[model samples]
Target chain A: MIKLKILLNKLTPGDTLTFFATREQVDNTCAPFSSNGYQVAWDQEAENRYLVRISK
Target chain B: MEDSANYSSTFFFCTPLSHERIIWCTECIASGAGITPEQGRIFTVFLTGDALFSFVDATSRESWNALSKVPSVQIVADGDELRLHGLCVSVARAAPGICITERGGGTLFWEQLISHLAAEWKGTKKAAFLLCHPPYMSRIPVHMLRFLSGAYAAGLSPELYAYLDGLHNIHNGQRPSEFENIGRAIATLARKSGESGKDPWFAACSRCATARGYFQMNPGTGYCEPASSIDEITIRPLKEILSRFPGFYPILSHTSGGIVNPDRSRDQDTRPRLIIFITNPPYGTEWTFGGLSLALATAMEGIPTTVVFIEHGVYSLYGTHEVPPNDKVFNVQEMVAATLDIPSLCYLVHAPSLERRGIGVEEHLIGIREVQNNDLAQILWDHDYSATRILFF
Candidate 1:
């Protein structure tokens, strides 16, 4: 989750970072990004996979 | 973090398990607009889902073989040892457009595309997406809403064209016990866009809506009125979609449950031009019908459009076809002929596809410019990397 945050922190204000992760990873990542006023959204791609997007 | 300004933009590619699908991806990546290793685009290709094990499959070996030739494509595993006959999985281009690494675990393609929209929406300040799936039954409606939400959060106006069964999304008073309330979400977004003075435009096809019972004849006005749908949507004729297209940049549409756009660029083109490739036969499925519908619709609206019939799609233009009275299929050849009259629509038939299928130019529809395989590659490269979008059906 920290690695995901690090990945997202690199983006500019209008940049959206898309990564493949698990549900837990997305759930843990969303609050940090959203609290910072960045937009985060995700959808389940498969049974175990979730595609997460966070925009800064 | 690499400076976002330095690189054109980031792109993600997700492929399904089918070898043919992977072959398409390989072709796109190997082609000019795909990777552009010499260019500044950052690509993270996800081979997750059923495609994760594609490297080991016998039928997919050829596809992977083609992917290996692409510059900077790598499959990293076990101390960075390149596996799968020295062919790697995933294509990631780092700074200066040199390094390539296959990130092992990743999300699906649609998620990646939705994520990429932020960067895509930045230049346009407006994004238009086609919603053909009805709500509740398919998760695509939810996904579309998520995409719109993300775009809205980034300050981009969203335009939704509910066509086909997509008209079901705008139906009023949707209350799902276990799933997201798509209708309410759409209304909220519409309200927000209206508040922002962005001229919120959420339109559904009147023809389709009336067919789907979303529109009814009211005796008082003697006109078709929206019924059982949220107030945020306006039912309009299908041709009106053309006007909406020019007003937005980077229009996107997908087949059911899938995402298709591959390249996202920093250079933005406000001109809404479309290139639709028909690679399937006319009567086997709805692909030809749908592709031609969009081609005619957009061209009628005067957006410069090109329709290329490649692979089996060349079959669409070959010979005269007669669907028997009992058979429900429309003669796709007639559909191809209908577009010939549209001045703005240009039709191209792949020369190699014809040769492979033993089809001659004289045997097919007239007015189609025959494009060589190499030239087709060049045309695709030019459109895909810039503001123009290339769609495959």
Candidate 2:
């Protein structure tokens, strides 16, 4: 299991986030976050940027 | 301003289709005297939204026609060439190219056409280009105009910065009709070209580029003041905080050398004296309010002042106000809507925003007012107050 640090200064509900990660580890990493109620909005294949919505 | 000036003006024809839109290409030539189909061959370049059709001479026409079938083509034309030069579609395409790229949507296509002609044409002296559209259009967006001006600079042989300075001609009048012409021209150019030069609003800023004085956005990074020099002052908002202050008179100044001073010297004065500045300034460089410069001047004498900056969608207020959450966030359009209706003694302080981008807190203060939910006069009053501040950033 790999841990990633998230910066949350100006993060808002509708805003998007960008990050880099390997294709194989994406689904495994997202399962726990999703189960905890976080929603995955967009996963950019080329740039590896992800947009997620956090529950208010 | 003169018909003969059109001959020396450089012309650029931007279309979405590489060769398909021959009708528009012909129209551009006919508008300018020098362009004849026999002598002027049509060059079509494909770009986003639609096709760009340019007319040039034999050699360039052959090159232009070769790429007629390609996708995303942008065409450039020289004075002597009857054919057009086909360039990559996305080369300079963005806000700067909005005038040239977005013609189908009916932005100011004609103004940009003339600006292109002015940029490309050659003579012993500078010539004016007449931008023509299909006809029957009302208003054009200022941003589009800015985009076109920047695009014309990108396509021409000479440096665009100098060309833009000449076209703006800001030295002569504080408010010049050429500003409108340049605005119109820039809008047309952006529709033809897909590229948005340096910034989305670069051309608009370029019009005031030669104006003397420094305009600093980030403060410490240094300022963008030209050598020409103009009076510089900080803008503050007085209405929101200082409205309660007795004997506080607001003044508006103008470039025309006049002062607007409202009388608030009367004892027990219940009426708020509002003085609005409205005037036109020359196109090149100095920061002058579009129609509000005059109003400021009219109110300058014996009146305490609050300055407002309005341009594009941004607004800022100067003088006194509670600190807003964000200093840079403001909506001039909404503020104008609110200030126009209130009957309180209103003084419209008109000034150009020193910064090219974003509205500051000070500009918003002078232009905006809060009204209780249902009062119509308050709404209308607020709207009037905001509308009184002219935009010429």
Candidate 3:
């Protein structure tokens, strides 16, 4: 449980953030930026953790 | 708390500070179960500098109907979106690596590596993405290699210390005849009881050439069996552990930059081994068959033999992989499976390589283990001496 904006503050374009979350949460988390111009991709990790990459 | 909508940009990949996890949230218009405004979050993972990847649960999520249709995708650069998606895992770059093999404990290894990195990268902005496998263990033998191997794949990519298996000292080079001689001598005593004793296994295998005593239990079956050779004793459980967590082998030591340059001469072993680097798919059956056939012949010589899979070669282990018709080597996969029974024969794959292609260890054949890509260099270093040639296909 973290504030997604704080991560956006530290991340330069091309940085990636990896964590475990459900499909619904992930879509919600990315929805705001995806509607904008942020370029992101999704990946899967062990234990169902999702790897999301953003390059905006 | 800042509103989630306040953040403007979304990207792929980030580097989290030590002891901390980070996230980035954004909104989209995708539909799925429990969907809330189609939110997306970015999390941290492996690579050089920072890592970038893409996925949509990467699993066959029944609820993720929209994502399930795509199955695989990679989001590396900015301005990239899921043109089509279900799931994917990307290969991040190699990081710094260090190993404390059999000689020193983990503490010393880490301290030394940190010091060395500090010294070497003194004016550079390079961060430490270290792979650590010290000679100590909480779980004893099992998880130690995986911890090191997985960490290596996570970004560590340098060799920090020398490691020895100590298998040489465990066995004193006793050939099968000596084993037989000793067994026969012991059997003579059993005659006093008027009961014939069974021959102690390992009377003449090179694997026992230097073993004091070597034995192992079968994994598929619980039966205790004589170790075919000395190396066999160490090999059996090592393979079993890898099978239990097959990806650890690949994750520890597999990478493109990690491979020995084919143009350069390979390292030599006092005891020459048949080391085959498999680098293709079944569709390229000629190369695959050639390597597999040579591997079988080499194993017959009682030489320490191994098959290393790189790139798409990792997929060859898939249970569903079928030999192409008109193949020179019929049932190549079966041949590989049969070869596992020989203790000296080894199989290694790269975990990230498989993950990059959305493959899992459970989907592969039994007995094969995955190591990190970088481990290949160390394997060549540890096994192959300078001035030798390793057959590559």
Every candidate's lDDT: 0.60, 0.27, 0.34
Question: Candidate 2 residues B1-393, lDDT tens each?
Answer: 012221111222232223322432333323322233232222222122122233232223443443332222224322111112343233223112222333233333433443433332211011111111111121212222333343345443111111112223212223334335433343334343335332221111221232322222334433233332221211111111122222222111111011111121222432223322222122222223322322222222212223232232122243333436775422223333332322332433222222433334454354443221122112212221111111112
TM-score top scorer: 1
Candidate 1, position B263, lDDT: 43
Model 2: per-residue Cα lDDT over A7-46, one tens digit each: 2223466654455543323443433343333454435455
Of the true contacts between chains A and B, what fraction does model 2 have?
A: 0.00
Return the lDDT, model 3, position B338.
48
Position B386, candidate 1: lDDT: 39
Off by over 4 Å in 2: A1-56, B1-56, B71-105, B108-174, B177-393
Q: Give the residue spans of candidate 3 off by over 4 A.
A: A1-56, B1-269, B322-329, B362-364, B383-388
B227-335: candidate 3 lDDT, tens digit per residue: 5333212323221211221111111111111111221222122233445667677555455655564454345334566787756676677656555687543554655
TM-score of each: 0.63, 0.18, 0.28
Worst 10 residues of 2 chain B by lDDT: B251-260
What's the CA error at residue A3 for candidate 1, in Å? 57
- What stretches of model 1 exceed 4 Å from their correct place? A1-56, B1-17, B33-36, B39-122, B195-199, B255-269, B279-286, B310-315, B325-330, B350-373, B383-386
